[model samples]
Target: MAELSGRFRELQDVTSSPTSGVPLSLTQREPEPHANNPPLYDGDPNSCRAFLSQCLLVFALQPRRYATERLKVAYVITLLTGKGREWGSAVWDAGASFCTDFEEFRAEMTKLFDRSVKGDEAASKLARLRQGGRSVTEYAILFKTLAASCDWNEGALRAMFREGLNFDIQDESRLRLRLRRLAPHSSWRLEETLPSKSHPPPQSPLAEPEPMQLGRIRLSAQEKQQRLVQGLCLYCGGSGHFALSCPLKAKAH
Candidate 1:
């Protein structure tokens, strides 16, 4: 601890002095623009990983700017606020040895602030998730987000996905299964035959209703023969037209 404190003091003195005879690499660095700075973290456990990940990305993109571990750690310190700022400020003021190592700093921050059990949390949420009124696309997107962290096998994922779907979608899936079992690329059109509970087909206004039929009295064979001989209609026994062009038959249709 004493050696680390002395090293920290030496670094501080070397940075503060203009001609301390320190190596060029140990000298103070010029200020850079903060346009690419990561979002400020306020010690929210949920956002800790995301904030650190952004900082890492910035460091990766501009390696020359953050060449030293201290520079990387200092840059992250500047972005902290709230409880995070207090922690960073205390570490910086005390000149902690870990502050000179970015990897150690990151690991410490993760251990301190990251409280989430990602796989367990994801699995719990996925177990309770339901499609409800949402579309299949929307449901699938949400399901996939949780499924990524669950580490479940493909069959388990499929079962969970199907279980979360709306009742209507489940019914359609069952119909699809039946169709597949009947034939590959079956000709049966379930969608056309079965109407949706949400939206039923509308009746056409232009369609005509069937006309009522009138019962005819029984006629003897001689009467029927006489009607046929007289070019009369056999259906109604009308003389104006034959059975093929009968007005009563057309009217009955």
Candidate 2:
């Protein structure tokens, strides 16, 4: 970490203005299409890929902002929390060389935390996955995780997903299959499987609408990104705190 820090300082020195002594990167305006802040990571092996992917997305979208390997790695470290933060702190204290290189940092983190199978291995596990006693949502999350590493097409994936579902869900999905079978000779029509408004499907009691402040307009994707980067409350665009601790958001609840 000392070596990495020294390298970063050397780069900063080279980039510093002769008159102002401020680094050129710091003087430049932030890039557009600001990336959303990734959720804090807790060193869960199952979620490491997702966390890393979010970090990469942020870096990719604002290449100029994260032009240096040190900057990219530093951004990732800021998002670490709980066990993840502990691991990052240890690496920093140990003076690990990989801590400053984005690719090396990613490789090291993946080796330590990425446990998901890929390719044929992932496919095989997905094939054997069962809904069992878990909710459909839970099963689907697991299914999608494994499917991400597989090379299967949509239709094949759909079929595999259906096969792993619980009997009840399978029975429910069969209604769509039945409709398809009835129009085997006709072109596929999605509307055929949908219930009419006159016979609306039952709504789940747990699907209540979230509480919202009156006259509060939805933020656009760009606005959300800006608020997040500014360290402002995402709910009301107030400064000094983030969304989780926003009093306005708490009051709405």
Evaluated against the true structure, the overall lDDT of model 2 is: 0.64
| Candidate 2 per-residue lDDT over residues 113-172, each given as its tens digit | 887688767766775777799865567668777877877654445545554555444444
- lDDT of each prediction vs. the true structure? 0.62, 0.64
Clashing pairs in 2: 1-95, 1-96
Off by over 4 Å in 1: 1-35, 132-142, 167-253
Error of 2 at 172 (Å): 6.1
Task: List residue ranges in candidate 2 displaced over 4 A.
Answer: 1-31, 132-141, 152-158, 166-253
Best by lDDT: 2
Residue-by-residue lDDT tens digits, candidate 1, 116-235: 447766676776677788765566667666766766654445444544555444466565454344335424322222334564323323334322222333444455434544555556
TM-score of 1: 0.49
